[model samples]
Target: MPRILAIDYGLKRTGIAVTDEMQIIASGLTTIPSETAITFLKDYFAKEKVERVLIGEPKQMDYTPSESAKLIEAFVEKFKNNFPDLPFERVDERFTSKMAFQTMIDSGLKKKQRQNKALIDEISATIMLQDYLSRKNF
Candidate 1:
């Protein structure tokens, strides 16, 4: 089976995650600059078989779209234009950053290591992917 890719899009950086070939485990892939995310995905898809791309949909406590949603929507539009054949889905991303931080702490990461924003972003993407996997059998 092909892998399912996930993205945690931010203003400056975008975190990436992917499922195993058997689609059992979700793992952090990398964090790339938002400016270069399209190029990065293009390169990645060229080498790997991704069945779908799951983008994080940030929401507020009231379940309304967060301020960051506009930027993410713009990026999604571009992504669709760039890869028309690729499928996309949205997964609710709430408290993913905090969850990532806790995950780092639980894993015994040092203070300095925990401060790495890129690592946090990657972990956030992984958490989002894991959450999605847990909710759906797919």
Candidate 2:
């Protein structure tokens, strides 16, 4: 029972999340520079067992691909080339950021703490992972 990883990809920063081995919980892992995300993931995978990777796919209100999608696609292409054995899936990321912000607020985080973009990113990834888990059976 390997864990499933989720990625909220961005041009400057990337958010990461991972599920427990039992696939019952998804938690924020960390945020890293976009340029270093692949190397980071490679190192992480070498240390941990990951069943698959779910990347957040940004979309416009009309369901069209967002401008940031090109950046994500490029990164996904390189990631697949680098880790051919690992499976990858895309999850709709609409409103995840807003949801993350609300989560921070509900958690009683201070204004300054909630303003941290890295924290927002990580939480966004967590939300995306949770959404995927809810829709997936088992």
Candidate 3:
């Protein structure tokens, strides 16, 4: 089976994650500058068989779309124009960042390591992918 890719998009940086070929495990792929996200994805698609893409959908506590949603939506439009053949979905990403930080703490990462925003973004993508897998499985 082809892998499913997940993206945690931010203003400056974007995180990427992908499922195993068997679709059993979600793993962090990389973090890249938001400006290069499309180029990075194009290269990635050339090398991997990706079945779908999942983008993190930011939301407020009351479930309203967050301010960042506008930027994400613009990005999605560009993505669709670039990869019209690839289908994509948006998954709620309310606390994935916080969760990633907690994960770092639980794993005993040093403060300096935990301060790496790129690492946090990558972990957030992984967490988002894992959450999607869990929901889909049950």
Candidate 4:
């Protein structure tokens, strides 16, 4: 089976994650500047057989769309335009960042290492992909 890719889209940086060919495990791929995300994805798609793409949908505590949703929506539009043949879905991303930070603390990452926002973004993407896999039983 082709691998599935997940994206944690942020204003400045975007995190990427991918599943194994069998779609069993999710692993962080990279973190890139948001401005170059599409270019990065285009290259990655050329190198891998990605079955589908998953993007985190930010939501507020009341289950309403968060302010970041606008930026995400804009990005989605660009993504669709670029990869019209590719399919993509949105997964709830509420608290994924917090979870990633807590995970870092639990894993005993040093303060300096944990301060890397790019690393946090990558971990957030990994967590989002894992959550999707868990829900789908894949």
Candidate 5:
């Protein structure tokens, strides 16, 4: 089976993750500017087949849509229109950023590395993909 790709999209940067061929493990790919993600993904898909997309869905503590929800919604809309054949699943992105930061600190990331919020976003994307993979799939 081909890999499943996950994306944590932000205004300034987007983090991409991918599952192994067996779809058992998820790993962070790279953090890239949002404007370039579409082109990158297009080229990637042209080279490699992707099964589905898992995106971080921004939500508030109470499970309500957060302010970032609007941007994500727009992105989703564009995604749907651009890639109608591909399916998308959403994983609530609550404290994934916080957890990412914690992971980085614990992993011994330098102060300068920690300062790059894109690193946090990449880790967050990994977390989202891992969490989704832990669940039972139909």
Candidate 6:
């Protein structure tokens, strides 16, 4: 069994999450600058067995590409070039960030704590991974 990695790609920062070998749960890994994400993933892959990489695909209400889709496309192309053997799957991530923020508020996070968008991004990655896992099980 290998881990499944998920990415919540953003223009500034990218959030990362990973599932255990069994893929029963997803946990936030970290948030890093988009420029640094590929380097980090390369190092991570060297030490861990990753079965698949899940990339969040943002969509508007009309089911069209969001503004950030272009950046994501470039990022994916770069990833495929760098890690040609790795496989990727796209998951919708329209409101995962908002959901993560709400979860933080519900958990009684202070205003200062809630202001950490990086954390929210990581949570969003977790949400994406969770959704992927749930859909696979069904």
Best by lDDT: 3
Over 4 Å off, model 1: none
Each model's lDDT: 0.95, 0.95, 0.97, 0.95, 0.88, 0.96
Question: For candidate 5, lDDT tens digit of each residue in 1-138?
Answer: 988888999998999988888989989988999878778888888988898999889988899998888888888888888889988898888899999999999999999989988888889899988888888364
**What's the CA RMSD for each of the models?**
1.0, 0.9, 0.6, 0.9, 1.4, 0.7
- Would you estimate the TM-scores of all the predictions? 0.97, 0.98, 0.98, 0.98, 0.94, 0.98
Model 2 per-residue lDDT tens digits across residues 1-138: 999999999988999999999998899999999999989999999999999999999999999999999999999999999999999998999999999999999999999999999999999999999888888965
Could you tell me the lDDT of residue 98 within candidate 1? Answer: 97
Q: To one decimal, what is the Cα RMSD in angstroms of model 1 from the true structure?
A: 1.0
Error in Å for residue 64 of model 4:
0.8
Tens-digit per-residue lDDT, 7-59, candidate 4? 99999999999999999999999999999999999999999999899999999
* Model 6 regions lying over 4 Å from their true place: none
How high is the lDDT of residue 48 in model 3?
Answer: 100
For residues 42-123, write the lDDT of model 1, one tens digit per residue: 9999999999999999999999999999999999999999999999999988999999999999999999999999999999
After best superposition, candidate 3 residue 77: deviation in angstroms? Answer: 0.4
lDDT of 5: 0.88
Summing lDDT over every window of 10 consecutive residues in candidate 6, give the lowest-scoring window: 86-95
Better of 3 and 6 by TM-score: 3
The top-ranked prediction according to TM-score is 3
Q: Report the CA-based lDDT of candidate 1 relative to the real structure.
A: 0.95
Quote the lDDT for 103 in model 5: 93
Please report how far candidate 2 places residue 38 from its true position, in Å.
0.6
Q: Residue 135: error of model 4 in Å?
A: 0.9
Per-residue lDDT over 16-126 for candidate 6, one digit per residue giving the tens place of the 0 to 100 score: 999998989999999999999899999999999999999999999898999999999999999999999999998899999999999899999999999999999999999
